[model samples]
Target: MSNAPSSPTGPVNRLAETTSPYLRQHAHNPVDWWPWCEEALALARETDRPILLSIGYSACHWCHVMAHESFEDPGTAELMNRLFVNIKVDREERPDLDKIYQTAHQLLAQRPGGWPLTVFLMPDDQKPFFAGTYFPREPRHGLPAFKQLMQGVERAYREQKTAIESQNESLMAALAELEPHASDALPERSAIDAALQQLDTSFDPEHGGFGDAPKFPHPTNLDLLLRHATDAPQTGAPDRSALAKAVWTLERMVRGGLTDQLGGGFYRYSVDALWMIPHFEKMLYDNGPLLALCCDAFAVTEDPVFRDAAVMTADWVLREMQSPEGGYWSSLDADSEGEEGKFYVWDREEIRALLAPAEYAPFAAVYRLDRPANCEGRWHLHGYRTPEAVAVDLGLEPARVQALLAAARATLYVARERRVRPGRDEKVLTAWNALMIKGLARAARTFDRPDYLESAEQALAFIRGTLWREGRLLATYKDGTAHLNAYLDDYANLLDALLELLQTRWSRADLDFALALAEVLLDQFEDPIGGGFWFTGRDHETLIHRTKPLGDEAIPSGNGVAALALERLGHLVGEPRYLAAAERTLKLAAESIRRMPYAHATLLFALDEWLDPPETLVIRAGDERLDAWRREAQRGYRPRRFVLGIPADESHLPGTLAAMAPGERPRIYRCSGTRCEPPTESLADVVKPTS
Candidate 1:
C-alpha cells in the first residue's frame, strides 16, 4: 500500500501527522494527498477510487495558484496519482468540509464557485459527483486542462457510473429542498417590513453597496438597516426609512476602494460596483465586522466620517492584526508579490514618482487620482475628493485641504510600509479573536481609547492564556500550538468576547470566563433534539452532517452569534439558562428567519432582543470619571441597549442584572428588566436621560 512514489515525489503521508498549516502545505504534494479523515474515506472505499475533493484556504490566492499550477505538476502529479482518491480539505479547518463541498459546488457549478475547490467524490459513500474551480494546466483561461480534466473525470468514473450516480443523486435531492414557507407568519413587524422591502430592492443607489458587481460588506445588511431604522416609529412605520439607506451605505464604504485608505482595515471584497476595485483580502473576520460597522456608524451619525472610520479600524487592529501573544491574526494575503493588487495598486506614474512635481497634482487631485481609469491602468480607488476638491488643488484651507491629505496619507502610509507586505495569516482565530474582542471592546467604549481598552485587555489575555485548553475552548492558534476542534464558532465567538469584556472591564474574571464558556456552549454546541448551534462538538469526531450553523455566511451564525451571545449572557448573569438557550436557539432558526431575512441579520439582532429588550446601563466605579461616564454612555443610538460597568468590589449583578450602589465620584445605573435607576454622578448626569 505504501506505493512510495505517489507523485509530488516522497514524504507527507497523513498530512505529516497534521496540525494543519493548511495540512502542512500539502506535504510534498505529488498527488497522493489524503487528510480529510475516516482514513481518507476508507482509502476511497478500498480503492474503488474516485474521491478527489480538494477545497482550500491558507490565505487562498487561488489556493496558491492551484498549488503552484496543478498540485505541483510532475505530470500533474502522475495524472492525479493514477486517477483520483486525493482528498485535502482545510477550508479553514473543515467548515463542515466547507459546507458539504460548497453545497456540492453550488450544485455542480450551476454558477458560484471560489477557492481552489475542485471536487468529484463517489468512493462508494463520499457522494459528490463533480465540481470545478481552477483547472488550467494547459488549456488556456477559458478553462478545462488539468490533464484533460483528469482524463475526462477518469472516463466518467469508469464509463458513466450509473449516469454519474444518477446525476449526483438528483443534485443532492435538489439541495435538500427546504424552501416552502408562507403559511402566513409575517408579524415581527411584518417580518421587519419584509426586510425593509428587501433592502429597498437591493439598494445600490448609484454605488454604495447592496448588490451589483461583486461588492460585499453586507455587515449584516448594515445591521438590519440600523435595526429597521430604529424600530420604525415603534412599529407603526413612520415614513419607512432604512436608516437613510443605511447611512449612505456606510458612507460609501468609508470612501471606497472598499476601504484601506492608506492602511487601517477593510477589503475582503469590492470587485467593483462603485466600491471600486479591492479583492485584497484583509479579513480577521473582515476587521471585526468592519469595526462593528464603524462603531455602529459612530453611534448613529455623530459621524466624523463614522468616527474616523472607527478610529482607523481600531488603529488597523492595533497596528496590523495585533498578536504579540495578544491574539488576532487570521488573514491578510490577497497575494503580495505574486500579484493580486500587488501591495495595493498605485501607478499614475507611481504617484508621479512619489509626489513632488509640485506634490503630484495635489496628490493626484486628492486621491481620485486625476485620470488613470479605475484599476488595471492603476490608481484603484480614492473617491470622496471634496475638501472643496482638496481646497482647489491644495492652495489650502478646507481645513487646510484636510490637513494636507492627512499629511500626504501619512507619507503614503510610510511608503506603503516599505512594500512587500500582505502575507499575514499567522492564525489565532478562536472565532476571529472573539471578533476582535468585540471590536476592540466596542472601540474602547465608543472611542475614548485607553489604547482601545488596552487592546481589549491584551486580547483578553491572549484568549485566557493561549486559547484556554484542558477545560476546552481551543479552536486554533498556530506555531505555539492549540490545534483545531473548537468550533460552534469558537465557543460562540469566545463567549461573545467574554461578554464584551464583561461590559467594559467589570471583569469578575471576565464574568467568570463568560460564565464558564456559557456552560461550555451548553454542553458542547447544543441542539438537543434540534434547536441550533452545532458546527461540531458533541464529543468531536462525528460527521456525515451534524452542521446546524444557521445562515449568514461571511460571518454571523455561530448559531446566529450564539443566539446573540445567549441573549447577552442571559442579561449579564441572572441566567434563565442564558435565556433558555436563547429561546431554543431562536426556535431553531424560526424557519430560517422567515426565509432569509437578509440572511438572519444577526438573528435579527437576537430577534430584537426577544422583541424589545435593551436599555440597561449600570456603571458603578471603575474611575477615570467612571471611564468618562462609560464613554458618554456608548455615544448614543441605543439599539435596545445593555451597558453594565460595575466595579466597586463587585457583588452580584448578572442574574439578569439590577444592582448599583456606588455614588461618590463614580456612578450611573440605568436598567430595564429587573428594573432600577437613580444613581448618577454626572457625565452630565449620564447624558441627561439619553439626551
Candidate 2:
C-alpha cells in the first residue's frame, strides 16, 4: 500500500447515497461498488456470480491506498466489475459483517486480518472461499496483482465448486465451534493474578508499553492495571510495579507523537515502540477511555502530567469532535491533501519562523526540533526534554521557560490551523458516542469540570433523542437519518456510560434509559443457552455466523462491557436477573480469560467485580451540599466504589436506593453486594479507609 495519492476517475455509484462516510468515500471509484444491501446480494445470487466484498473504514490509510491503486484504476475496476458483484462496506457501520469476515479471513489464511479486507464469497451462501487484506495493484510483497487475483478467484469458483462447498461446510462448523460454552464452575482469582503476571512479562520496562513496535492505546489493559494497582494497598502490600507500568506508558504517550502536541487528541497508534511516529488517524473510541485513564491516574498519584493530559484531551474533544447536534464525530482521517500526516508534521524552519528567539529556543529544545527529523524528513512534535531541563540550559527559570513554550505552542497552533485540515467522519455512531460520553463524564467528576459534564450530557441527550427510537437504538445517525440495527457494543457501552454519568450527576431519566438498554441487551443480544451476548442482535441481519466474542478487540468486548455493566447495575438496583446474567456471562468467558488473560482484560474486570462486588454508595441530600458531599466522598481514586448523589425530594427510586430513604440531614448509605451498612450523616466516616 502506498501513501501517494491519486484522483479517482469514475462515475458515481450506489454508494454515493449511503450514510456511511467510508462507503461514500468510494462513491466515485471505477469499480461498480454496491453498498452492502439485500438488493446487491440478490443480484449476485441471480447472476450466479461470487461476491467481492471490501471492508474498510474512512480513516484507514491502507483503505485509501487500495482505493487509489485498484478501485480507481479503470482496467482493474473493469476486471472486478466483470467477474464479480462488488460490494463496499464501512466496518464502523456494519461491525457484525466485519467481525464475521475478519474472523473468516483469519481462519482461512491462518494470520491476523486488518482493514481493506478483501474477500471472495459464494453469493448463494455468502461463505468466503478466499480472504486477504490490501492486495497490491501490481504483484508485490508476495501478494497477487488485483486483476490476476480476481481472474483466478473467478476461475476457482467456476471449476472447483464441490471442493469449495466442502471447505465452506468445514468453515461453518469451525465458526460454530468457536462459541464459548458455559462453565460449571466460576472463574477463580487465579485468572486475574495470571493476567497481571502476563502483563508484567510483556511490559517493556524500558519503554513503558507492551510488546515491540506498533503500540496501540490498549486502554482496557491500562484500566485493568490501574484498578489492580489501586487494590494493592488493601492487600497489605503495594504493587508499585503495576502503577508504574500504567503511569509510564501514559506519560510516554502524552509526550510522544501518539498525542497531538498542539491539538491535544491522541492518534490511532504509535508506529514505533518509543510512542513516536503515529498512524495519524484520530479516533473518538481511543480518546474516550484514555481520557478516563488520565483522570484516574491523576486521582491516584496527584500527578500534574496526568491532570494536564486530561484537561487538554477534554478540551480537544469538546472543541473538534463534538457535533453541532451534540453527538461526537467518529474519527479524523489519517491523510489530508493526499498525503499522510501532512497537516500535522512541520519543518524546523517553520517553527523558527513562527516563534521569537526566546520562544524558539525553549520550544525547539523541548520538542526536539534541534534534532534530526524523525517523521519523513519533517518533525512531528514530541517532548524530547522537560521545560526545567531546557530552562537550565538557557539559564532561565522553569516558570519563564513554561511561559515561552506555551506562547510558542499557541502561535504554532494558530499557524497550523491555516493548513488543510484532515477530513472528519461526521457519522454519529452510538457505540463510539457512548465511549466518549463515559470518558467525558469520568473526566468531569475527577476534575470538577461542569463543562465536561455538560458536554457528556449533551451527547447522551443526542443519543437518547436521535438514536433511541421507539424502544431500540439506531447504530449510526447522519444527515438527519438514523438507521441500522444497533449492535451489542452500542447497548453495552451505552449502558456502561449511563452508569458513569449517573455517578457524576444523578438523573432518573437516564437511569430509565439505562434499564431500557439493558433490557434490549438481554432480549436482542444475549445468547441465553450459551451464556454470553452475541455481536449482532437476534433481529439483526442474518449473516453466516453468529459471534459471541469474549476477548477485547480495538474496542472492549461487548460481552465484557455488558457483563461489567450488568454486574454494577444489578448491584445498584438490586436486580436478581441482571446479576444472574452477569454471572452466566462470566461462566461463559472464564475459559477464554484463563487461557489468554491479557487479551481478556475487560472481561477480567467483570470477573474481578464478580469475585469482590463493588461498593455502592447512595448520598441523599436536599440542598447544594449534595454536590459537596458527593465530591468529598470521591476524594481519592476509589475504583471499587460507586457513588450516587440523589436529591432528598427525588421520588420513584429503584428498590435498592428506595430502601435507604433520605433524612432531613444529608446521609450516606453504603452497600457491598447484598450486605448494607446503616446510613451515616458524616461523609468522612464513609470515605475513610477501614483498618
Candidate 3:
C-alpha cells in the first residue's frame, strides 16, 4: 500500500510529486512515470532502460483514450514500469520537445498521426529508436496490445541494444537530410505555375474547396490562389476567368456550413469536400487564418457573405474564447457528452420540439434539415439555402431574405448557447493569440469596426503585461501565471501582430516592441549555420536535436512566420540584415517551397517579397478620408504591401525610415526602395489600382 498508487503489481515513481494537470491525471496510474527533467534522463542512463516518452495535450481525445485503456490499467502499466523509464510530456507546454519527437515518429510511421505519441529512446542520449501513436490495452483493430508491444520493445532494447541504437542513428541521419535547400536546379517559377494549374484542376468547381473527403480550410493556399486570380502578372498573361472562379469558390466557403451559421467561428475542418458537415473541434489557429482570409475576400468582392462570416468569426473569438485578462483560449474540444459531434449534432425530433410547429418546417427547409440525416441516425446540420434559394423559399427579395436569415440566426445562436457547450481549453497560447490579434486588427481596419481593433489592443496588452517578463515573452498563461519559454512562433507571430496593430492604430510602443522582439528572435532562434530558425529559444531546455520546422501544419510553419517577420522588420526598421535573414531562410527552404508551394503560404508571401518587394505606404497625417484610403489599400489583395502610419505631429518614425513633412492635407507616399512617389492627396488615386 504505497502512497504512489502501485497496484502491488507495478513499481512506484516520482510523477506523483507534480501538479501539472496533465501529469496529475496520470499520478495514480500503475505505471511508474517520471516527469521530464535532468533527473529522469539520469535515471534512464543509470538503469540502462530505454526511455518511453509519451507526449500529448490535455484536451486530446486519443490522449484520454490511451490514459484510460493503458496507463490506468494495472497489468499494462506494470509491464511498462518494469521495463522503461516512463516520461510524460505535455506537448502544449513543450512544443519544442513535441516537434523533434513527432518528426521522428513521422519518419518511422511514414505517415502522420496525432495525440498520445509514444516514442522509445536510448537510455543515455535519449535518441529515439521506435515511435508510434496510441495502443489498446489488449489486441484490437488489427493493432498489437500495449503489453505485447512493450515486452517486444523491452526485449529488443535488452538483447539487440546495439542494433536498435544503430538503426536510431541511421534514422537521425535520414531526418537531418529532410531540411529544405535552395538549389540552382529547382524550376522555381515553373513550379509556382504548375501549383496554380494543379489548384485549378484539383479545385472542386461544383463545390468550393480543394480535393475530396476531409477538406481543410487551407486558407493560406486559398489566399495565395486568390492573389494569383486578382493581381495582373508583371510578365505572364492574366487569367481573369481563373481569378473569378477562385473568388466564386471562396464565396461558397463563406456561405456553406464550413462556416458556423449560428455561431461566429469555424469548426476545425469540413469532413466532406463540399464544405459541409465539419469536424466538431474548433481551433484558435484555424479561426485566425480563416478570419484573415475572409477579411481579404470581403475586400476583393465586397460580398456581404464574406463580410458577415469575418465579423461572426471575430465576434465568436471575442465572446467565447477571449480570456478575462484579454488573451484568447487555445481550442474547443471536438467531443461533448461522450460523443465527438454530440454538442453540434441534432435530432429531427429535437429540432421540432425546440421550434414552433409552423416555424420548425420553414427553418428545417431553409437549413436542408428535411433530408435524411447525414450522421448515423442523427442530423449533422449543414448547407442552408443559398441567397437565390432562400429568396424563393421566403417569397421575398434576396436582400430581404438575407437580412431575415441574419436576424433569425442571431436568435438561434442564443438558444444554442443555452445547451451544454463543448469544453473550452482556456490556456492562452502566445503564438495563437498573436495570430488572432493580427487577424482581428486587420479585420477591424478592413471592416471599419473599432470593436475588433479594441479586442486586439486588449489582447496585446494582456500578453505584454501578463505573459512578458524582462523583455522576453512566455509561451502559455493560465490561472494568472505564465509558464514555458516562448517559442519562435510566439516571437514571430507577436511581431506580426504588432505590425498589424501599428497599421491599425499607429501605436509607437507597438512598433518599438515589435522591432525589439524581432531582434530577439534573430539572436535567439536563428540557426546561423543551418540558415533557418529553431522552434525553441536559445535558453530553453535542449533536446537531442534542434529542429528547424518549415513544413506547414495546422498552423503555418514557424520558419514561414519567421521569414514574414524578418521581411516586415526589414521594411519597418529600414535594416537590410532583417531582410537578409529572411532571404537566407527562404533560400534554405527553397527546395521544399518549390516542391510544395501550396503548403508554404507564408513562404510564398516571402517569395513575393523577393519577386516584387512590398510597397511601403507612408501616411503623414490622419484624416478620416486619408484613413479610409489607407484602410482601402490595406483591404485590397496586395500581398506585397506594407503600411506605416505616421502622425504629422510625431517628431520621427521609430525605424531608420524618414518622416514626412507636416501638412494640413493628408498625403500618401508610395516607396519601393530609396525612391518615393510624388505625394498624392486624392484618396481615389491611391485606391484606383486596388480595384
Candidate 4:
C-alpha cells in the first residue's frame, strides 16, 4: 500500500460558508470538502459513490494532523474527491450524526472511538459499513496510506456488492441492539449501592481517580460520590467511602500538570496515570462541571485546596475565555505553532532568568526542576512537593514559602504571555455556555463572590438577547451567525443552569426563561408516544435516525439533564405535568440505571431525587441576620434541600411557594408537598435536620 503521493496543495471549498469554526478550519483544504448537507448526500447517491464522513471538533489535535496529512495532500485529496462525496462535519455542531456514526465505528472496528473519526457510509441510507480514525497520508505505523485505503474500499464496494449489502444488514441489526433497556419496573434506590460497588472495581485508591493511564476526570461519577458522601452520615448510606475518593482525585488533579498552574484552568485530561502529563486542550464543558465539583468538595471537606481550585478556574474563564459580548467561548486548542504543549511548557533556564534567586529556590524544588523534563525536553510545571514539604526542606515558615512561590508563579505567568498561544474556538455554544453559567452561579453562592454572579448574569443576558429569537433557541453562535436549531441538551442544560442561578439570586425574568425552555422541551423534544426526549427538536432537519440520548459522554446526558430540570422546575412551579414527564423519563431508563450506574451517574442523581422528594425552605426577610442560620442549613451536602429567601417588601409569589408569603419579621418556613410546619424565628432549631 506504500506509494509515492503527489505533493500537498490548497484550494478553497464550500466550508467557507459554514458557521462552525471546525468546518471553517478546512476551508482551504485540497480534499474538496463539502459541509454535511443534502447537496453532498444527493451527489453521492446520484453518482452511486460512497460518502467519506470526517467528524471532529475545533480543539481536536489529531483532527488538525489528519487534515494536514491526507486532506491537504494532492494525491490523497484527488483520490478522495474522485472516489467519494467528501463530507466534513463539526461534531460539536452535529452531535446527532457524530453519536450515530461513532457507534457504527465501534461496531465495525471493534474498538473504542475518538476524534478525527473517518467513516465510509452507503450512499442510499447513510449507513456506515467501514470506519477508522486518523489515516496517514502515506503508509506508516502499520496503517495503510489514505489513498491506498480509499482505493481498496472503492474496489471492494464495486466487486463484492452482494457481500457488502449482507454485512450492512447485519451491522444495521447490531446498531438496533444498542437501544435502551425496556423494563416494567422503576430502578430501586438500592442501585446506588450497586453502582458504588461497581465503581470501586476501577477506583484507584492511591491516586484518587478511576482506572489507569490516559485518565479522564469523570465529573459525573465524582458528583455522585460527593452527593453520596454528604448523605452517608444522615441516611446511613454505604457510599461513605466516596468522600475519600473524591477528595483524593481533586487534590491529585490540582497538584498535577492536568491543571494549568500558571494560567488558571485545567487541561482536558492526563496522558499518564499520575495526572502528570496532560493532553493540553482547555474545554469550557470540562471546566464547568469540574468547578462545580470543586465548590462542592470544599463545602463537604472544608479543604482549602478545593476552594483555591474553584477560584483559580473561575478566574481563568473570566480572564481568557469570555467573549467580547458576554457568552463563554467553546474551547482552546491543545497545540500552538504545529507543536502540542508549546504554549504551556517552560525552559529551566528561562524560569531561572525570569525569577529571583530567592524565589527560584523554593519554586524549583516544589515544581521538580531537578527532575527530567516531561514534555519535549521542557518542564510542564507540575509540582512534585507540597508547600509544607517545601517549607520544611527550605527551613522556613510555611507562609513565607507560600508567598515566595506565589510571587514566582506570577512572574512566570507574565513571561508566558509573550509566547504564541493556542487557537481559541470562539464559538459560543448554547449547551456549553449554560454549563459555565451554572458553575459560576454555584461558585458565586458557595464562595460569596458577587463578581462571579455578575459574570453569570452577563453571559445569561447575552444568550437571552442574541440566541433566543422568535420564541426559539439557536445552538451555536460565532461572528454574529446563529442558525442551527437548538437541541434538547441546549434547553435541558439551560433550564438546569437557570434553576441554579435563581437559587443564588432570584430574578423573575430568568425564572420566566426557565419556564419557557421547559415548555419547549416538553413540546418540541419530548417523545409523546414513548418516554424521554430526543436529541433533536421536532423542528430539526429530518435525518436518517432521531436519537434519544440517555448516558453521559463528553457531557451530561441530555435525557438526564431534562429529567433533572423537569423535577426541579416542576416542584418550584407547582406543575404536575412537569413532574409526570420527569417520572416517565426515569422509568424509561430504569433497567440501564440498575446495570451501569457509573455510566449513567447523572440519571442516578435524578433517580435519587425521585426516591426522596426534597423539602423547600423559604426564608422571609425580617430584621434578623441570615449568616448563622443559612450556614447551618447548608453545611451538609443535602442535594435534596431547596432554600429560597424573600424580602418582606416582596409581593409576587409564584404558584410553587404561595404558601410561604412574606411577613413583617424574619422567619423560616419548611414545606414538603403543600404541607408546612409553623414558622420559626430561632436559628438553632432551623439548623436541625429531620434526624
Top lDDT hit: 2
Name the lDDT value of residue 605 in candidate 2. Answer: 87
Model 1 lDDT, residue 449, Cα: 77
lDDT of 3 by residue, 450-505 (tens): 99998999899999898889989899887666878899889988888888788887
Query: In candidate 4, what are the lDDT values of residues 426-490, reduced to their tens digit?
Result: 88999999999999999998988999999999999999999999888999898888878888889
Q: Give residue 134's lDDT in candidate 1 (0 to 100).
A: 83
lDDT of 2 by residue, 546-633 (tens): 8999999889999999999999998888898888889899999978887898899888889888888888899999999999988877
Flag the better candidate by TM-score, 2 or 4: 2
By summed lDDT, which 10 consecutive residues of candidate 2 come out lowest?
Answer: 1-10
**Considering only N, C-alpha and C atoms within 3 Å, which residue pairs clash in candidate 1?**
7-30, 8-30, 557-560, 573-654, 573-655, 574-654, 574-655, 574-656, 614-640
Task: Please give the CA lDDT of all the candidate structures.
Answer: 0.73, 0.90, 0.76, 0.84
What's the lDDT of the predicted structure labeled candidate 3? 0.76
Select the stronger candidate by TM-score from 1 and 3: 3
Off by over 4 Å in 4: 1-11, 233-240, 622-637, 649-652, 673-675, 681-683, 689-691
- In the range 208-320, model 1's lDDT, one tens digit per residue, is 66878888887888878886676554666623367778788888878778888877788888877878777887888878877877887777778687888888888988987
> Least lDDT summed over 10 consecutive residues: which range in candidate 1?
178-187
Clash pairs, model 3 backbone: none
Runs of candidate 2 with Cα error greater than 4 angstroms are: 1-10, 689-691
- Report the lDDT of model 1 for residue 466: 79
Better of 2 and 4 by lDDT: 2
Q: On TM-score, who's better, 2 or 3? A: 2
Number of the candidate with higher TM-score, 3 or 4: 4
Per-residue lDDT, model 4, residue 393, is 87
lDDT of the structure predicted as candidate 2? 0.90
